[model samples]
Target: MQPSHTPHVLVVMGVAGTGKTTIGPLLAARLGVPYAEGDDFHPQANIAKMSAGTPLTDDDRAPWLDAIGRWAHDRAGLGGVVSCSALKRGYRDRLRAAAPGVAFVHLTGDRELIEDRMAHRKGHFMPTALLDSQFATLQPLAADEAGVEVDVSGDPTEITERAVAALAHLAPPQ
Candidate 1:
């Protein structure tokens, strides 16, 4: 088990296929906090749009983002982890507005690597074809953001370990 510390609230932010779903839970498990899957907050219409290879408009994502933001706000009180495709700085900013000190773990990788992973992924609504749109819409996590950028080229365990290590400062003092 991890050493005792204060709980942390983090959003595993990235484009599809960046392994947010895979790594968020691992990080949560390691930290002994609950995990929230961001996708579950999406409206059916948004899922249908993405599943059909259409990118969601900002309007379409407004409620969804608000929902996740609210969740983050609530979870922060107890400290938890969540997976969110917080692709833009605005989206992350909204989350921050909801939960003042919430942190993020931005998973990233090259197009080739992400596309390769997407091509093989099964049962996910996001099509590989939309990867370009995701990339196009992405605004890299700003230097001033409260978070860490993790490369997704490694295995989930290694990636999660890196995230945990990077967030070491979040641990509450004994």
Candidate 2:
């Protein structure tokens, strides 16, 4: 188990296939917090749109982001991890507005690698063709954002270790 630290939520974010769903629960387990799958917050209509290979417009995403924001806000100081494709600055901003202290873990990787991973993954609605749109929409965390950028180059354990290490400073005193 991890040593005691402050209770703070983590939003594991990145484009599809970056392993947010896989690594988020691992991070939460290590930190001894609950895990929320962000995809679950999407309305069926949103899923249908994605399933049709249509990228969601900002208007289409508003309610979904708000829902995730509410979840994050509710978990404040209770310590939780949630997976979100927080791909845009505006999206991240909406989350921050809802939960001011929520920290992000932006997973990054090469596009080709991500495409291959997506192609092989089963039972996911996000089509591989949309990866380009996600990349286009992604605005890397600004220097002032409260988060870390972990490269998605290794196994999940190694990546989690890196994320944990990177977030060490954010942890409160025991």
Candidate 3:
């Protein structure tokens, strides 16, 4: 793809444990942009609910999505990458509405692999029990969505490389 100079924000998305968090910063660094942690946008109640192994309802996620949307909106033209479990099309739509130029990088992997990774993660509020709910909620990026899906089957660096390559068309030209 031919490169362009217009700056934009990329939301790295997927079900939990799909490596969105690990790949987002790597991609941002590769693209010479800043990175935001999507989880940081969550309110304390949301974190508490997730920590208790309860899957969040849409209402519970509204403020969190709005916060992330605002961040993306603010980063427009400045360029940034953020990690989020944007498992539903509606959530992504909300973000895109807030930041019209926002693109996405959907990290995907086998459920077994994701669950294994979740089981091994430390200090993360999300528990493995919520994996099924996340999967159930996931609606893969549709044909109309501005995004690319990268398989998270390899190491973080490898996945990041794949993401950088996949998303090159969206990045500003050097």
Candidate 4:
């Protein structure tokens, strides 16, 4: 399918280790758009909190979420994809406020698989110990949300293909 003219801002969203980082770029490439890694927008304090195994309060997350939201708005203006762990309804709402037409692609999987992925992963601030809290905080996207949910337990390429195809359907005709 050809790229759409609509402001195709896709947020690759989920709890940690759900392949947002892996699939986001590929999805962007498939759509011929740029991509942003949401983690880069987090403040050092927030990173430290997660690294220290403490969950961030909404107060702590608001600024970080706003930063990501602003980035999404900017990119949506130019049409792009973004990887974000927008774990709560409020967070997603904030993102929507910034980018009105933004769509989310939620990657979900079994907790065991996600925990295993987190345990073996490296150089990320969020620890596996925090997985439970992450899951606790996660308010999965509602059915009416403007996006698709893809099971990410399979191969990365397959997950990317699924996300790409889903986004393709949502994208406006070229």
Candidate 5:
């Protein structure tokens, strides 16, 4: 695609502690768009389940995903960023259905690295105990998905920079 200044929605996606919360706002700021934290849209039941070290089922996450999708859909025309675990392809598809043309930036890293980060994290509902479940459910962006996968081995600033640079040329699935 030719260079353009059009604004777009970008889903900063990954499991917990991959820096979705840390990097999403930064990416949005760099893009000059509004940002939303996907966690804020989670229903209390979903939070309770995760907080209890329970892996949320697809049934438990439907509304939460819908809410985040709605937020993205509302801001799609002018561009925005939102951070979501979006572990499953179906979940991402739900978000995409609500807001077509939105792109994704998947933060990925080694399991040990992610678990270490999760273990040291505080004040988050997600427990490190459920990380394996998260990983099991995670579906990397498919060939038909519009996205880029950025390794989380770098510093947050560098990761954000990489996301911005990648988005410049990334194309949405047709």
Candidate 6:
């Protein structure tokens, strides 16, 4: 399925444990676009801090966000999906600056559910304790923002399908 001319950029953004990693690829596959995991761009030091249970400062994230933004801009030429926390409006703005027509897909769910998932998850740098900081830093995308918000509390397939449908609706006619 080719993307519409409106240029939809899926930003699988949310606090830790929102399943951005898991859902991003599925959404991309459904959309027939490549998927980019935002965590892949994290600097080693940032990974170390998060692994040590420390919350990253905005300074720690700026370079990473810039990289993701650039990646999004580059990939959007052919169209693709990218997963990122994009926790702040400033960060989203930076992403938008890189790709003017980029859109977001904000995933949200209950804090307790997210924390539970974080605790059980392995091989990930982010810790469960940092969930608070993530939520604290998160500034939900405005209604008018170029994006759709979906609750990720349900099954992964359900979440993906909903997001895909939402994107289809938001996308311009082919």
lDDT (tens digit, per residue) of candidate 6 on 1-174: 565564566789999999999999999898888898899999999999998988888899999999998988887657789999999999999988888778889999999999988889888878788899999999999976788889997889999988977777674412
Cα-based lDDT at residue 162, candidate 1 = 88
Instruction: Please give the distance, in angstroms, between residue 84's alpha carbon in candidate 6 and its true position after superposition.
Output: 0.5
Q: TM-scores of all models?
A: 0.93, 0.95, 0.95, 0.93, 0.94, 0.93
- Clashing residue pairs in candidate 3 are 4-173
Clashes of each: 1, 0, 1, 0, 0, 0
Off by over 4 Å in 2: 1-4, 171-174
What is the C-alpha lDDT profile of model 2 across 1-174, one tens digit per residue? 464656778899999999999999999998899999999999999999999999999998999999999998998878799999999989999999998888899999999999999999999999999999999999999987888899999999999999898888664411
Off by over 4 Å in 4: 171-174
Q: What are the per-model C-alpha RMSD values against the true structure?
A: 2.2, 1.9, 2.5, 1.9, 2.2, 1.9
Q: Candidate 4, residues 52-72: lDDT per residue as tens digits?
A: 999999999899889888987
lDDT score, residue 126, model 2? 99
- Model 3 lDDT tens row, 1-174: 222666669899999999888899898888888899999999999999999999999999999999999999998878889988889999999998888889889999999999999999999999999999998899999988888999999899999989878877554412
- Most TM-score-accurate candidate: 2
Q: After superposition on all CA atoms, how large is the RMSD of candidate 4?
A: 1.9
Stretches of candidate 6 exceeding 4 Å from the true structure:
1-7, 171-174
Cα error of candidate 2 at position 85, Å: 0.7
lDDT of model number 5: 0.86
lDDT assessment of candidate 2? 0.91
Better of 3 and 4 by TM-score: 3
Model 1: ten consecutive residues of lowest lDDT: 165-174
Tell me the RMSD of model 3 versus the true structure: 2.5
- lDDT tens digits by residue: candidate 5, 1-174: 222655778899998889899999998888888889989998898899889989988998899889988888888668889999888889999999998878889999999999999888789989989988888888899988888999888788898888877887775333
Candidate 3, superposed: residue stretches over 4 Å from native: 1-3, 170-174
lDDT, candidate 3, equals: 0.88
Worst 10 residues of 3 by lDDT: 165-174
